[model samples]
Target: MNEDNAEQGVIRLLRAAAHTVGPGGRLPSVRTIMAELRVSPVTVQHAMRRLTAEGVIEVRASKGAFAATRRPTSEVPDLEWQSVALGAKPPGDESLRDLLTVPGPEMVPMSGGYLDPELQSVAALGAALGRAARRPEAWARGPVEGREELRAWFARQAGGAFRAGDMVVCPGGQAALSTAFRALTEPGDPVLVEAPTYLGAIATARSAGLRVVPVPADADGVRPDLLNAAFARTGAKVFYCQPLYANPHGAVLSRERRPEVLAVLAKHGAFLIEDDFARDLVIDGTPPPPLAADDIHGHVIYLRSLTKSAAPGLRVAAIGARGAAGARLRSARVMDDFFVAGPLQLAALEISVIASMAASPHLAAAGAEGPPRRAAHGVGGQTPPTPARHDPVGRHAGVGPPAGRRRRRRTDGSRRGPRRGRLRRPALVRGRPAGPAPAPDVRRRAARGVDRRRAPAGRRGRGRGDTSRIVNLRPTFPVVIPAHR
Candidate 1:
């Protein structure tokens, strides 16, 4: 009669029916069980749920529940021989693994290498992906070098002499780095990297069997002298560096040091793998051009990625080189994953997506306008002669200074500058300076006249029986607090 008793009775009847029907037989319908047992549908559903969870029955959508099939158990086989067949443990990148490990819900992550989920343009990216999915070409296999349009856009981003023909679209920055490492060097060859470079680069190089040699870097980026020394000492053919906003340190290679770095590479006849990962993340001031832009003889192999600026799912990156080096990178990319997914490549280059990303506050500062406007918009048809000061998606989108006012910046990101005169005070406050305090009014005071001279010291000028004190909350700031008796 009760819910629990009814449920148990229904479950018992269903079990008997299943036994009678044998395995894989249809169980009694909920309506039939309810009609025969005189029980509610909830009771029947509860019993069915219990049976389903216990694997005593299987529920198929549209079709009624049926008895579950019982398969015979087999003996477990040992996998110990796998270790012997695989031989010694391959080098483990514990740091890289830890970097990629996601934290639990209770944990607040401070170590994640990617942009915070709060800052990602999830809605825009999703919409773009949806649009891309509808295209017939998105499902088709793209060129191994990547979609032509995407490559051309990357060329524009790279600036310099790099062209669409020179670009190889890879899955992401990490994959591009791995492909470059494998393509350029043989196993056990020394590859020079900044001392505190991106861990993914180190992990990729080591995984590719290349010996990583560290070249010290400072606030201005990798030290030219030390880099030169390392190249001479190790005879390394490849040197990886982050020119703008280097990972971990946020160091931008200084104007003075950029030429020196290139000279060092040229002297050693080595290649510089410039990872311009943060090119689009410039919050203030103009970003410098990629080191690859200055290279005429192909000493620089440039890499630019949208993964950081856009959502992490937009793992599109361009790895580019010139002449023979470019061919090697393209060949290497073909062997690794063949080509990036067509939908992802198309999404990155889609005009709608590019416009959406440019307008997104997550990608740029709110209300930032004016440009070579080319950089702020999508790169579709022709390539520009020079790269824009910032990545199109990551350009600083702050409004420029008003006419005749020179803009200056402060540590807190507030704008300060010279103005013609003091700002007009509110007239409603009777010509008195507008601030936290109320303006003087003789009429108001006279009407509510209470002799301030006769009032208690603590209550003077304040409402009746005021016992408040202004406390100095030192080390933070002073605030008015009420001191009750």
Candidate 2:
């Protein structure tokens, strides 16, 4: 073998020997190793040096090599005092940690409202980032309230009286939540939220030292009467709401209830923090205009996020408000990070433009190629699951009615009578028909093995028909129920 391979083999042998010997035990001598492996003294010396460096063995100046002793527990540094200095952790910290925990390779994550890595728009985001990087302005400092074009885009999405001046770009939804909570309310102040709201919102509000009072909400969204009562009871000046596609439960505020909710906010003299994060994720039909769009009186502070609709790394979101609230949001964002990175803002703008243009009828009229259109659609042409219906009661609407309740049809195409039997009991084996036992004579013959097919006399005890090799098929169909038995 070559010198390198010989040296490596010697090291492996020495390592194994070191592990075999107990702590502080003497290992085989260098001369003995050289003699046994039929290698030169240099190989043994090199292996010993490496093992010594690795702490697997120790080589004294005069003494032979020996296994290194493991350090005792008492010799290690103590860290228990840090626990006393840090004090108690905040509530829901563990839950938040669990929520944010990334699933391992073996895990199939079903919980949490996040897009799988497979579903994320990786290619488009990378391309957009590349485009953004090519632009010289993208590397410069951006406005604290974000670029005017991006803000204008957000304003148009907000749809009503919202303008570019009212929009403040933020890092992400959580950061935007933190900024809004800190901006609108003071410490120890009460903030109203829906009963089954986003966990991140709850955690953020609590971290900001605000008392979270839950206003009862159902499938139709938060009840206006309870919301008003909650405001009065808690004396809260701010209410955080998700009118469209509320997280966790995915409830939307009904049209009839929208006016009532607005009236309640006016009655209580409160500001509604509208989280319109999932505005772009429509799977079925068109979503309604944002609640902030309907607010002409400046009671609503609208927050929209692109993190969900776009790739997760595209952490761009906007908070839109009319008057003083808008200014407070802008100031809060400035204090948080001065301003979002220019390149990220530019990349986000690029992605938004591509998505919007792809959806426009004008793009096709411009004679864009099919590949380019599909590429603009995003990674694998996959989009976030945002049901378009105004009031989708979760994902149940997409799934058909339960099997037992399904009605049968007649030959004439009219409705048939109610199911008489146990819904035509399913068979144990898929394609095989289920029925009663065989005739008495057949059963007797089977018991005696008289009617069983067998191999020729000479090959009976071997080959495919060997009794020991034959598999019993009786247990394969475990359950065989019949219509008449």
The candidate that wins on TM-score is 1
What does candidate 1's lDDT look like per residue over 1-485, in tens digits? Answer: 88899999999998998898988999888889989999998889899999999989988999998988888668687999999999987753655654454443222222333454655667767877789999999999889999888888888778756989999998899999988998899999999887555667878888888887877665567789988998898899999898876654345788999889989988989999999887765554778888888888899999988887777778889999998899999988877788888888877876333545446576563213212222222221121211111122222111111133322211110011012122121000011111121211100000012221121222212223222211110101001111111
Cα RMSD to native, each candidate? 18.9, 18.0
Deviation (Å) of 278 in candidate 1: 0.4
**How many angstroms is residue 265 displaced in model 2 relative to the true structure, after the best TM-score fit?**
0.7
Runs off by more than 4 Å, candidate 2: 1-75, 116-118, 352-485
Tens digits of lDDT, candidate 2, 1-485:
88899999898888888789978988988888888888999888988888888899998778898889988867779899999999987533334543454433222222244443444566777988999899999888878999999998888888766999999989998899999999999989988887556667878888888877777566678899988888888899999898876754456788989999999989988999999876655433456789887887999988988886566688888888887888888888888898888988988887633358346332232222222222232211132221221223221111111122322221110011012211111101111111121210000000112111221212111222111111111110011111111
Q: What is the C-alpha lDDT of each candidate?
A: 0.63, 0.62
